[model samples]
Target: MSSAAYERIRNNPKFDKLVATRSRFAWTLSAVVLILYYGFMAVVAFNPTLLASPLGEGRIATIGWPIAALMMLLFWVMTGLYVHRANGKFDEINAELIKEATKEAQ
Candidate 1:
């Protein structure tokens, strides 16, 4: 059987490279964020006092609000990072693929 879908996609080296790059980046970012967020939660869970104390207070600005704000900020930052990379790099790859496919079809 012919693998038209696979072949069509694989024929474009840039497409594969782009996909791999995006996948790697996404995985790495996810792991980092997951580790940081979950690690914080785990520490907090284990030692509630640590997160609630003045010195060991989870966040800088006021403990509770600060921690919440920090988490929101971090999540937004990650989202922005992903959007930037996807638009700058992945979109280029996608455009090239579409152009090539259209050309081939014509």
Candidate 2:
């Protein structure tokens, strides 16, 4: 694409909104993952016994195992969520922005 096209898109409010929305979403997801993982680590560091406790009277596995698994699953789910939103909403807006930019340039 030409510099003019790039400049046109860069100046578009839709382009700015796309960047802002994507950045906010990515940061939010990162914060959630950090909080969850760090919180888990903090618990393990400060209160190891809590995470070490068995799931039930006779169970061998600790509760932490499942919680950790869930955290991992959460990361995957968040990834999918971003991908879905990017493909559906963000991409649509981006295409529209490009079309507008091209029209404006022409």
Query: How many residue pairs clash (N, CA or C atoms closer than 3 angstroms) in each of the candidate models, in the order given?
Result: 0, 0
Tell me the TM-score of model 1.
0.77
Instruction: Put down candidate 1 lDDT per residue, 1-106, tens digits, no spaces.
Output: 2455446767888877988999999999899889878888886788676566553446454365567578879978998999999999799888888777666655
Instruction: State every prediction's TM-score relative to the real structure.
Output: 0.77, 0.90
- C-alpha lDDT score of every prediction, in listed order: 0.77, 0.93
Model 2 regions lying over 4 Å from their true place: none
Candidate 1 residues lying further than 4 Å off, grouped into runs, are 1-6, 55-65
**Cα RMSDs of all predictions?**
4.0, 1.3
Least accurate 10 contiguous residues by lDDT in model 2: 97-106
